[model samples]
Target: MQETLEFPDLLRLIDERSTAFLAAVAAAPSLDAMVPTCPEWTLFDLVEHMGTGRRSWAATVAAGPRATAKVEAEGAPAVPREREALLAWMAESTRQLLDALREAGPDRGCWVWWGDSQSPATCGAVARHQLQQFAVHTYDAQLTAGDPRPLTEDVALDGVEEFLVTCCATTSAWPHEPATIDYHATEGRSWRVRLSADGARIARLPATTTDEADATGTGTAGELVLAFYDRIPLDSLELAGDRLVFDRIVAWEPE
Candidate 1:
């Protein structure tokens, strides 16, 4: 299994790449490049979205048990008009957020709207949540800037699995079910994820063998990651048993 990371992992990756995104924002190709594996966003909007997400998480975490919703459908702050100024603003905004997250620390209490209503005091799960969000979006920004390689398989798979399990609560695109899916990597790693009306709950796989799933598929980790994001072709899956379940998986979307 890939070594798991705490919330600070994101703080680190964000610090390293935020500047990369800043330096290339204007020169970066038009926002039209769909985040390849991420699909729903253009590079421009993805960076803008993540930049705002940093603020949203900070605000929510700082607020403690009572977090409020303040969404601006427009997404992100307006650009400063001057290219250099915009980059600086973006760069500064990200760094400031990094500082805010650091000062608050993972132990600070938080009320998150997504995933297993959590307090930052017990923050390992929160780290997984924020890390995947930031990592995928960072990939989008990097892709827009013309560097398209994905994060390491373990990282991508973590995010991809997180997205799949959480899709029911986060979007109407998925057909919600109480059924569970146990994910296994050929490389001796597995995560058992359950999706239900309560949303997603993930746990480490049990050592004992369970019945074969209603359906199963196998492929490279990267391909599985893209499929989870609706970026890869579902038919590409190698399935055994109850193949129709695969169709439903293809239909899922966060929207």
Candidate 2:
């Protein structure tokens, strides 16, 4: 895994990216515009989802481990029809989330649904999770506005590592036979992922290694991260080795 980012740094990123996301929402010509990346969601729905998600996470950080019930009860708020009002609401939600995270501090114990029992449920994990959420949704907002920008290299690389370690490892089923794939990001970070009927395992590879693998994907860090999450098409990547192996790996849906 890539080195854990400091909690304060993660909060800073959340602030920056959340601003960008709301800006895109503001620039959107129509709230009814469908987000191509998330076909089921219109721009209005996306904004509400992002804002309410931040509020729910903020509540989780404040309540700590005892917050699970509260988190579940806090559903997303209804999307506002007026454009300016929606933008204001988004800004307020972001500010509230940042305040909650700062108050909780890095090591403060908190409930995180994604964290395994062995992993410490702390404010840091919530911050990291929110950072990735902001990054991805910002891209979604931009894409909807028809001027998608790639994530920064550092954030994309960390996101790739996070997805493998967290999402892939927890997937419970594999439709195809076991296989291994190597992901080499143009940013010079790489990881080895082993997928089987049992589950998936991931390891960060030494930068200089040249070992062969059953399948390999070469792409920019942002492309790799987006592709891994099925946010972008697989053809966007440069594939070598066994294409089927790579396909099967990506095809697995997390339980």
Clashing pairs in 1: none
Top candidate when judged by TM-score against the true structure? 2
Give candidate 2's TM-score. Answer: 0.89
Model 2 lDDT, full chain set: 0.80
Q: Compose the digit string of candidate 2's lDDT tens values, residues 1-255.
A: 447677778888889998899889888889999998887999999988888888877787778766655463255556578999899888888887899889989888887665532234788766777788899999999999988999987778878887777666654555667778898999888898877766677888997777888999989989998897678988889999988886566555656
Instruction: Report, for all candidates in order, the number of backbone clashes.
Output: 0, 0
Weakest 10 consecutive residues of candidate 2 by summed lDDT? 112-121
- Judged by lDDT against the true structure, how good is candidate 1? 0.56
Tens-place lDDT per residue, model 1, 54-170, is: 666655554554554523323445755455665666676666566656767767655555533212233344445666665555555666677655566666666655554444333
Q: Best candidate per lDDT, number?
A: 2
- Report residue 19 deviation for candidate 1 (angstroms): 4.7
Worst 10 residues of 1 by lDDT: 115-124
